[model samples]
Target: MMIKNTAIIDIGSNSIKTFVIDQEEKYSKIVGFDKSMSNGFDGNKINNFDTFVDSIKNSINKAQKQSSSKVKNIILITPTSKNKNHLISEVIELNGAQIEDNHLRQLNKSMIIKYKTKLTHCFKSHYVIDNKIITDSPIGINCGSLSLNAIATIISDEEIKLFKNIFSKIGLNLIFIYDSSIIYYLYLKSLNLHKKNIVFIDIGSSTTKILTIKDEKISLLKTLPIGSMNITNDLMTLNISKDFAEKIKTKNIDLILNDHSSVEIPVWEELGKNQKQTKSYEFIQSIVTARVDEIFKLVLSSIPKSKFFYSYLVTGGGSMQLNLIPYVKSKFGIELELVEPKQVKGIPTFWNNPSIMLPFCLNSLIENGYIDKFNLFKKNDSFSNKIWYKRFVDLL
Candidate 1:
């Protein structure tokens, strides 16, 4: 059987991860994986661009060494640090002529120009044609005028420049750039979950993203600055290294109360001295629980009360916490489901880690033809066609 190779680069707030996958007709195998910490930037801008670029270069090189194929095209996924959403409406007069794809494209282009923001993704809610509402495309239908309602997610231009420069430096072409939340939404929708009014919570090291899907469409996307890292930082007050604190956070710890139970935590002192500290399990749990509670509270407050979601799904590294599911349920009065890459068939067991879920989803989408390959590199020509062409050529 013949195989094709593709690569995915996921730059999150806490880390930069790269994956190389080989896909046949029916299955995909992860051939390479490389990850590097972001030096505490966690998706935010840092003063040292060269250091950040070097980190990305090292990660890509490691993954390349593990793969057999040369990685030419890359799908880049980045978290939305200061993401903004707008419900934009655009109308175009048809003058009793049939609507065409170009007409709809023009309308979309106009909206993009009007917003004047770097758009990450846009989903059309519905189209109004001659007073008739349609969820699908209204192409080839005679209408006096057509109006479209869409939700657009926007990110900072500076962030895009940073990633583009990093990729250019590494001699890789960016075929697709997506907001991490959008990628997660696409992955969940692919699972055939078929749940209406679903809420997705993705917890990362330094941030958490919340997205709501209504009628199988993304209704909201939000990111909060607080994430699992906050809990780890809280544990650092015990004089433990961040690395050790992270290990404790993910070590099947329980949030339930056991007042009399205690666990001994070991730490390294100066001069290579070994020190053992005894602390009540309750104390550690209390520190973690407090931060988690704040995270959930902020999530709840950000979501509008009028919106009703029947199902809630949590994913990402932070969601791997042993008691996160039950704790979220008890605190928010909503049952939460943990999403795992294992749920998707044909993915190797070793590649089931949540940290690589974004790249895995991108691979699946590309292999299944859900997302067009060539179209991934195209830019919107709404404002100026010439400018779009120039930009496209420049990327080449």
Candidate 2:
């Protein structure tokens, strides 16, 4: 069987990652993978646009070298900065004509034009025709009027322009740009794990995102400025390097203290001189625990008052710290489970790392035909048969 290939570029605040996957009917393998650290933010916004574009180009070039096919288009997963989700409804008068695809397109187009925000993804929750709710497509049905209820995930137009400019420089077309939170929600729903309300927390290097899933759909999304890096910075108060602080954060030391116990860690004083520093496990735990508490508090404040019927799920590189599960449970009173890529089949073990889970989830979604059927990308209406449309005809 011939395998189809897809490439994904995930741009985050802390790193840029590129991955190429080749898949048959039911299985897929990661043929290429590359990553580069993002330059820390300049003030409140991302550093230089040109510098970030260059980093992305370098990662994509490395991935292309490992793949057998050239990557001309990519699925871009963007950060949640300046992104918002809104539930909108619009009524269309059919004038006693049958509803058609064109009418549905017009409705969506009107919403976009009215809001003036660049759409990242839009999901049609349901349609009401003549006061009757319809879950499926309402096309070919005779009706005087119809209403569309949709959830529009959007970001600033400036951000969209920035990504388009970056991809243009690299000779790649942006196939789809999805908010990172939406990607996680889709991935979780694909696993059939949303029979009940689910609270998802993704702790990235620079920011943490919280998503609320109700009735198997995303109801709310909030991003906190604090993340795992804050804990690393907090450890810097001990006069340790960032790298060393990161190591301490991920170390498999017990955070739960029945009694006061101290652990001595070696610190580099000079080329050959090292000093053993005694630090109580409670002290180290206090630093990390404080940050985690603040993150959950913000998340709780954002979500509506409701009971969660399912386990809280947590993912991302920051959430991989040892004993994080217990820390969250003790502070938040909710047991949290770390999401493992092993739950997703047909992918290599190397692709299971938390650092690249976003790309991995995207590959799985594409392989299962979810993205194309859902119209996740912006549609091109021009008559010209561009190379992108020719290559991804099914998607268009």
Candidate-wise lDDT, in order: 0.70, 0.69
Per-residue C-alpha lDDT of model 1 across residues 27-140, encoded as one tens digit per residue: 667677777776534466665777777777777778778878887666677655565666667899889998889987787677767753345566555577876654556987
lDDT of 2 by residue, 253-345 (tens): 445642547756667555756777889888887887777778778777777764345458888888877777887677667788887665443
Candidate 1 has an lDDT of 0.70
Q: Any runs in candidate 1 off by more than 4 Å, and if so which?
A: 1-6, 22-29, 89-156, 190-192, 257-260, 306-309, 343-351, 373-389, 392-396
Per-model C-alpha RMSD: 4.8, 5.7
In candidate 1, residue 342 scores what lDDT? 53
Q: What's each prediction's TM-score?
A: 0.79, 0.76
Model 2 worst lDDT run, 10 consecutive residues: 376-385
The TM-score measured for candidate 2 stands at 0.76
Candidate 1 residue pairs that clash? 13-42, 13-43
Number of clashing residue pairs, candidate 1: 2
